[model samples]
Target chain A: AQSVAQPEDQVNVAEGNPLTVKCTYSVSGNPYLFWYVQYPNRGLQFLLKYITGDNLVKGSYGFEAEFNKSQTSFHLKKPSALVSDSALYFCAVRFRPGYSSASKIIFGSGTRLSIRP
Target chain B: EPEVTQTPSHQVTQMGQEVILRCVPISNHLYFYWYRQILGQKVEFLVSFYNNEISEKSEIFDDQFSVERPDGSNFTLKIRSTKLEDSAMYFCASTPPGHSTNNEQFFGPGTRLTVL
Candidate 1:
């Protein structure tokens, strides 16, 4: 079965420091990787996706992700962390079975990223 | 920007009772989907609808769960009989018509269902 994994349950970084939220996937065929962030009491916001282009994908809120095919990892990153960037981050992979035209998103357990002053 | 919208941010229901969660996808979107996250759990896909029919569903989307696009603008998920385990944050999503791998789904804020 296809699945996503976020090794860290929580990641803490000092404000203005760089941050990384790790993610890896187990799936067959080429994978469509995505990053989503959820704020308290808010819906999941799409951050970025790696479809077929460059290994580095940029997204909203100054967030970016690096898609590494050899390792099957798509890690979310930011050059400088902000308090407002603290939220739950999820890594997801879109999978479509060989026989099915419809695809479903398999999400990681999620990692809570906290930025402290 | 156009975004998916869900009704009733929260809903409380009793076990064995029926409940319907409503959503209005972006006007131009043709693919709709429902996903749920149990508190502290990964988000799980329930079902996907397209061309006015269910295109796919997950194992968790048992007979008790059904989805429909009742009108031009409203898509709904009806749980025939709610169970305590059904308590979750249900999210509705949609994307412009395209191959599944190419379209990125836009998600709604989600409805928190509390089954007692």
Candidate 2:
């Protein structure tokens, strides 16, 4: 089956420092990658996505991600971390349904990002 | 900004009871979807609806579950028989048709279903 893996159970970063949450996927054909975040008691929020363009994809709240095809990775990154950035991060991949169906989106286990003040 | 909205932020139901979760996606969106996340697990896709019909569904979306776009504004998920294991947070999401740069699924606050 197609899936993405988030190796880190949790990532700790001091406020003002850069942060990274790793992700890698295994899927056939071109993949559509996305990053989502969930706050305590809140729904998942869209962060960024990588469709078919440049390797660098930037998203909400000063967040960004790098798509490395050869490495089969799409890691979420932020130049500087804020305490507010602490949340549960998820990496997702959408399996494009050929020409007759809706896309099935798959999510990674999740990475807890704790940004310290 | 227009966003998806869901009813009954939290729901408590007895096992074997039927439950319906309601969602109102953005007025202009063309695609609707349902996803659930058990406490510490990944969010799993349940089904996708478009043009008043189901576009796709996953294995978990068995006969027990059904979706209906009752009107122009509401899309609902009905679980015929709720089970204790069905407790989770259910999210409703929607996205536009085609692959536009803005074609990202917008999600609602989600309804937490607790079956006892």
Model 2 lDDT per residue over A13-65, tens place = 99999999999999888888999999999988999999989999999999999
Give TM-scores for every candidate, taking all chains together and pairing residue i with residue i: 0.98, 0.96
**Superposed Cα RMSD, model 2:** 1.4
A32-112 per-residue lDDT for model 1 (tens digits): 999999998899999999998899999998999999989989999999999999999999998766655567788999999
Task: List candidate 1 stretches off by more than 4 Å.
Answer: none
Fraction of true inter-chain Cα contacts (below 8 Å) kept per model? Answer: 0.71, 0.50
User: In candidate 1, how many clashes are counted?
Assistant: 0
Q: What is the C-alpha lDDT of each candidate?
A: 0.92, 0.91
True contacts kept of 1: 0.71
Q: For candidate 1, give the lDDT.
A: 0.92
User: Model 2, which residues run further than 4 Å from truth?
Assistant: B100-102
Predicted model with the maximum lDDT: 1
